[model samples]
Target: MDKKLAAEHLLQDVSHYHGPMIRQMKQLVDIYIKLAELETRREDTNRKVALPREIRSVKQLELVPVVTATIPVDRSCQYNEGSFPFFRGLSDSVTVMNGINAPKVVECFGSDGQKYKQLAKSGNDDLRQDAVMEQFFGLVNTFLHNNRDTWKRRLAVRTYKVIPFTPSAGVLEWVDGTIPLGDYLIGSSRSEGAHGRYGIGNWKYPKCREHMSSAKDKRKAFVDVCTNFRPVMHYFFLEKFLQPADWFVKRLAYTRSVAASSMESIFTFDDIYPLSA
Candidate 1:
C-alpha cells in the first residue's frame, strides 16, 4: 500500500504531458532483459527482435542497478527519498484495507420504506446505514443550500451520530500538525453505540447504550461485544485492549500515525510524525 502511495507521490511530482524516465525504467528493464535472453538463446537460431547493438546510445537511467534484497526506499535509496518512506507492516498474514477502495452501496427505498426495515432486520443494518450515510455525505452542502428544515434535521442526525464519535476526535487533526482531540481521549472508554471516550466510527443511536460517569465503574460495566454489534468483532476492554485504527479525510492536511505503542491506538505518533512542518 505504501509502495503504491509512494508511486503516486512520485507520479504526481512528474508529468501529465508525459511519463517520467524513472517510471519508464520498469518497462525498460523488463524489455532489456528479454532482449538479452533472446540474444543468448540465438547464437545460431534467430528471432525478429534482436538486441540493440549499442546499449550506450540509449541515454536511459543507469540500468545496472546495485543489487539489494529488499525494495530499499529508505535513507539508502536517495532518489526515492520522501517518495516512499518504508514502514513496518501488519504481520505478513492480515489483509488490511487500502484507501483506494471506498465502497459505495446503493439501495432504494420505495414509498413503503419496507426495504429499510427488511435490511435492518436481516442483519444488514450496516449496509442500510452506510448507504444512508453515503447519500448524506454526498449532497449535504446542496441539501443545506436548498432547504432549511431538511438541513437542520440532516445536521442534527449527523451531530447526534457523532456524539459518540467525538471520542475519536483524537484521530481528527488540523494543519500545522496538531491533534484536534485536545483532552478527550485521556479518560474515555467507548462501548456499544457511543464511542465512549476512545472509540471511532459512527454510532448507531438505536443500537447504542453509553455511560461515562462514575456509574460505569460503580456498576461493574464491562465493554463486551453484544450480538447486535454491526461489524461482528469480539468485545474489548479499553484499559487492556487497543487497535491502531487510522484514516484520512477532509483532503484535510492531517498527520498520520508515524508509529504506535500498540495496535489499538486510534491515532499514534512517533518521531517521523508531524512531517508537515
Candidate 2:
C-alpha cells in the first residue's frame, strides 16, 4: 500500500512536465490503469472500479482510445480522427507552385498568431515512401551533427514535414526561396545566352527533335529508343553535354561529397562500400 502511494505521487510529479516522452509514459499508465479496472470488475460483482477523480477531470490530457480496425465500424466517429491535422484554419487564398505538376501552396493561421504554409499535391504516386526516406535522412543527420569528429563540415540534410492525406495525396511543409536542381543546372549552362535555357536552340536537341518529328511512327520510335537506352545514354554523354566537362566533374564531386559523408556514418558495416558493381 505504501509502495503504491509513493508510485502515484511520483507519477503526479512527472505528469506536471510535458514532452513526447512524458506523453508516451502517460499513455502506458492509462493502458495499465484500464487493464487493472477490467481485472477488478471481473473479480467482484459488487466492486465499483473507477478512475481517480483527478484523472477523470483532465479531459484535454486524456488520450482518445485508438480504433484497431482498418475500417471504422462506427460511421458517426469524429472527422478529426485520421484526417488532415490542419484544415479548419486554412486561408482561402492559395498560390500555385512553379513546376510541371503545379502543386498548391496553402497557408494557415495558428491560434498563437503564427502562419504556416504547406505544399499540397494530388497525384497517383504515393508520397509515403518519400516521407520515410526524409525521416531516415533526418536521423542520419542527427547522428552526424552529434559526432563532430566523424564529420568536420557542418552539412545537414534538408528535409520537410510530409503529411499524407491518402494513398495518392499529401502535403509537404513549404520551403521558401528554392528552385529545382534541374532548373538551376539549365540556367547555369545558359548564363551567357549562347544556348536556350531549356536546350531549345541547342544543335543536338534540334537534330533529335527533327528525327522524332520526321519518324513515320513517332510513338514506336520513342519506345524503341527507350527499350535500348544504353546507346542513347552513351551518345548523350559523348556529345550532348550542355556545359563543359570540367563543370560537370565539379558538380559530380559536390554530389558525391554529400553522399560520402552519409556513407561514412555507417562505415562500420562490412558492406558499407562495395568494391565491385
Candidate 3:
C-alpha cells in the first residue's frame, strides 16, 4: 500500500504541475489510428490508445470505464484495445520585458510594448541582437496561431518552389527572366488581376483552397481588376508556414566552385533566393 501511495503522490505532482497535453480532455477522448495492412489482407491496425486518466490508480485496473469519446465523422473504428501514455504539448504564454522574454526573476514590462521601447533605446550593437530574437519569436507566435486547425488542415504546396532549397525554385522568382510561375496557377475567375490559369502540368500551383489561403499571396493586382474580390488570392500573405529558410541556404557551401556566404541580416527569404521547384 505504501508503494502504491508513494507512486500515486509522485505522479500526481508531476501530472498536475508539468503534465504534457494542451488541455486535459476535460471530456473523454477516443482516438483511433489505422494500422498497416496485415499479411492476410485483414484490416489489422496498431492501436494508440490515449487514455485520459492514469490507469494504474483506477479501481480494478482491468476494467476502467470510458466517460466519453470524440469521434470525427470521417472515422472508421477497427482496432484492438490499447493504452496510450501521457504526453505534454508546448506552452504559448510569454511575458516580454524590455523586448526580452522575461525571467520570473524580474518583471518590468511585457508583450509588444517592451519590444518597441527596447528597439528605440538600445545601442547599435544591442539593437541588432535583440531585434533578431524579437522577429523570430514573432514568427513563432504567428505560426502557432495560424496552425490552430492543423489537425484537420494541411499546408499542401501546389508548386515545388515553396520548399526550403532548390535551384529551380530560386530561378523562377526573377525579373530578368521571370520564370512566369503564374503561367499556370489560378485565381477567382471574377478577379481581373487574378491569374486563374498557369501552364498545363504546373496548373496545381494552388493545390487546394485551404492551402492557398494559408500561403503568402504572390499575385500582384493588375489594373481593371474586379473591385469585389473577397476571395481573390491578392488579399492575403501567408508567410507564417513559409519559413525564411524556404528561400536559400546561407552559405551554399556544398557547391564545387562557389565559396563564402554572406547572410548579414534578416532579409526576406524571397528576396535572396526563390522558392524551390
Quote each prediction's TM-score. Answer: 0.17, 0.42, 0.15
Q: What shift in Å separates residue 75 of candidate 3 from its native position after superposition?
A: 39
lDDT of 1 by residue, 1-277 (tens): 8978997787677646445544555443443232222222222321122224442233333322211111344566455423321211111111111112211111212222212100001111233343444345435435543677645433222211110111111000112322224123221222332234334554432334553233346334223323223342122223323533322231111211112112112212332264354
Query: Sort by lDDT, best first: what order?
Result: 2, 1, 3
Residue ranges of candidate 3 with Cα displaced over 4 Å: 1-11, 14-196, 200-277
Superior by TM-score: candidate 1 or candidate 2 = 2
Estimate, for each residue in 156-212, the C-alpha lDDT of model 2 and write its tens digit: 566677655445566677777665543343333333222333334334334445667
Off by over 4 Å in 2: 1-88, 98-101, 187-257, 260-277
Using TM-score as the measure, what is the rank order of every candidate, best first? Answer: 2, 1, 3
For candidate 2, the per-residue lDDT at 212 reads 74
> How many steric overlaps are in each model, in order?
8, 0, 18
The C-alpha stretches of model 1 lying farther than 4 A from their native spots are 1-19, 23-27, 36-51, 54-56, 59-277
User: Candidate 2 or 3, higher TM-score?
Assistant: 2
Q: Report lDDT per candidate.
A: 0.29, 0.49, 0.25
